[model samples]
Target: MENNQDSRQRFAALVREHSHSMFRAARAILDCDADAEDAVGEAVLLAWQAFPNLKNQQAARCWLLKITVNCAYGQRRGQRRVVYMDDLSQAAGSAPSPEPSGLWDAVLRLPEDQRLAVMLYYYEDLPVAEIAKTLGVPQGTVKSRLSRGRERLKALLREEEAYGF
Candidate 1:
């Protein structure tokens, strides 16, 4: 049981280290700050329960991100209703930094697969193979998503610039 305690401690430390990245990735998928936080909370609980199954601590970040994305999807699925609110002040206060905000909004507009690929690659700095494994897709598929996402982001950014946003 001592070993189990040690493992749980280590896992908790790793979770603290990667929590921000997990939240960002979740937000990229879920599109709501509160929902993203909820997803991360759920992911952390699920990950802690499964900590004994983690073999390589070195891959913990990628592993955590996979859990986060899955939880975000589950959160989206569990939402019973969608309410459209025109009030923007609450959301405006939660915006990321200027550079990331522009890029983030563009990324949020991309298709789900592409948004995920871009987030894992650029935001988390995971390699292609690791991303493919996390996403459970072929390397070619991940690459395709990245390429298409970039093209779409470029166009979106251009439009934003033209609109002075």
Candidate 2:
């Protein structure tokens, strides 16, 4: 069908435009990066299948993020094995430790609402209103989450990285 062809093209374009957003949502919702990848991948597939229902192309990013988050949440609900990255044995103390992983460890320690808010606000660079809409919460809730999350990160990261500097 001509409509199907057009929809397919539009869907592909939207995916390219919002891939990073979907990936970020997946990463925040799923604990592990690999699981996040899987979630994003699954979300893309589901989005394409549901493309006909999308009325406004401009809404694609938010729509995709919703799918990504939902898919990651679903995966989390069904998963039991905890991913403990620290357990991986690195070669002898020859190499210095990584930085970003430590930061992420602190981020991951946050409560889910706070983690999601911080990620959307800082990483995604979304405003409070947008975050509130995406999260189905009030703007005030977003502000509180960002405030508390930032304070906690300041404490945790300083303790981890301050000794050297």
Candidate 3:
């Protein structure tokens, strides 16, 4: 019982430390904020169950994110598309149009592999090798994905600008 308590405490600490990044990574994949939160919660539960098998403390971030990505993908499966209705007051009011945060919408339009790689490497600031391990791909593949993602993002953003978006 004491050992279990210790494990729980350790897991809690790790979650507190890394949960934000995990949520962001999940959000990048899943799009909706609510789904991102759910994915992180599910990942924490799974991580708690498998914490004993985690050999390296240093690898906790990667491990937790791996679980988050898996859970996000699982959650995405069989989920129907949902369109949210905007508030009538906000919609009807002459509110100033918010400027787009550069390249974010374009990033969202990227293919899954490239999107994940770009999010992990650039947004999460994780090293390519670690990202490769997390994604179960080679370092070369991670690099290629990053390259392709960047190229695609540039093209998309330029097209948006040219069309006056």
Candidate 4:
């Protein structure tokens, strides 16, 4: 019981430390604020369940991040092509366009591998090796995905601007 309490405290602290980044990654994956929140919540649950397997405290953030990304991707994957609607005020009047659609839209359009790489790299500011470690993929794969994803995003943004997305 005491061990469980200790783990929960540790987990809670970790969540407070990295929740923002996790939400961003989740939002990036799912492309909706609500779903992102849900994904982060789900990831927190799953992370607690798997906390027994955690080896080092230092890897906690990355581990939680990876879980959150996977959870967001899983939710999106399960229900593909379902659009999330935001406020009419944002779409119609004020609210000031929360996040640049081109950036998020392009990121959302990326393939899973590339999207993960881009999120870990740009959002989390993780090194390639760390991303690879979190993703359990080779550093070369991470680099390739980052390169391709960035190129594709650039093209997509340009296309969006040209075609008015």
Candidate 5:
């Protein structure tokens, strides 16, 4: 049996390693930095409570991300309304590019399921199996969503280019 200190240290190391991924997952769902931060905070607290019960240390990243995503969904549901005060580009803590990229815009326009799958697969660099486990979907479903999201992004980018926007 693991001692309490060892458990705590292991949990802390896992959280520290995956914190950025957790925030990105939350951000993907919530679309608001503050709300995403709140979701991540809530996920950490919840995960801490559940850590002792976790069976696989290797699966910790997916487990934490799944918690973050659920918390983000719950946060979205609790909000009566969503207000966008900052430009989406500014949310990443960087100055807007002189030529703003439409790729991210197209991604935002993707259907929620496709968007989540794409973000988890590409942005988070998660494998399809892990994404499926994180999102509680089948691997085939995640693959299909990624395929569709790519096609949609290609069409959207083509349209943007043709319009000279």
Candidate 6:
């Protein structure tokens, strides 16, 4: 019983530590804040259920994030809607900044696979191997996605500059 209690405590602490990352990963996949929150909650529950099966405690972060990404994908599949990015920003509880950066806008415009790879690798500061684990893709695939995402972002920025928006 004590062992189970210890495991539960450890899991809760880890969840707290990585909650923001989990939310960000979910938000990257889902269209709205409510969906993202739901995904994260579901992921946490799923992770708890499978926590005992997890072998490498050192890889907990990647493992939790992998669960989160999967949950977010599931949520997105269930709800198909056209939601504006501005609405998402507002729902996240932050007023629109006077100077909105186009880099993030371009990142959001990338293909889903590339966007997730970029967000996990760059924004989350996860190593390529860890990103591969989190994304369930091979390291080479993650590298390729990052490469393509960067190229796409460059083109998007250039277009934005040309249009003077």
State which candidate has the highest lDDT: 6
Residue 129 error, candidate 6, Å: 2.2
lDDT on C-alpha atoms for all candidate structures: 0.87, 0.80, 0.86, 0.84, 0.86, 0.88
Task: Return the number of clashes found in candidate 4.
Answer: 0
* Best of the two (1, 2) by TM-score: 1
Question: lDDT tens string, model 4, 52-114?
Answer: 889898988888988997898789888756644556556777766633566756787788778
Model 2 gets an lDDT of: 0.80
User: Top model by TM-score, which number?
Assistant: 1
In order of appearance, the predictions have TM-scores of 0.85, 0.80, 0.79, 0.72, 0.80, 0.79
For candidate 1, write residues 1-165 as lDDT tens digits: 458678778888998899999998898888678889999999999999888888887888989999998999989998887664533544667554344337877888889889989988998889999999888889999999999999999988998888777
Candidate 2 shows a clash count of 0
Model 1 TM-score is 0.85
Model 6 misplaced stretches (Cα beyond 4 Å) = 80-102, 160-165
- State each model's C-alpha RMSD to the native: 4.5, 3.6, 3.8, 4.7, 4.9, 4.9
**Candidate 3: residue 144 lDDT (0-100):** 99
lDDT, candidate 4, equals 0.84
Minimal lDDT window, size 10, model 1:
92-101
- Candidates 1 and 5 compared by TM-score, better number: 1
Between candidates 2 and 4, name the one with more favorable TM-score. Answer: 2
Residue by residue across 1-165, what tens digits does model 2's lDDT show? Answer: 457678778788899888887887778777777888999899999998898888886766777877887898888899988745554444333454565547667787678878888887877777788788787788998899999999988887887777632
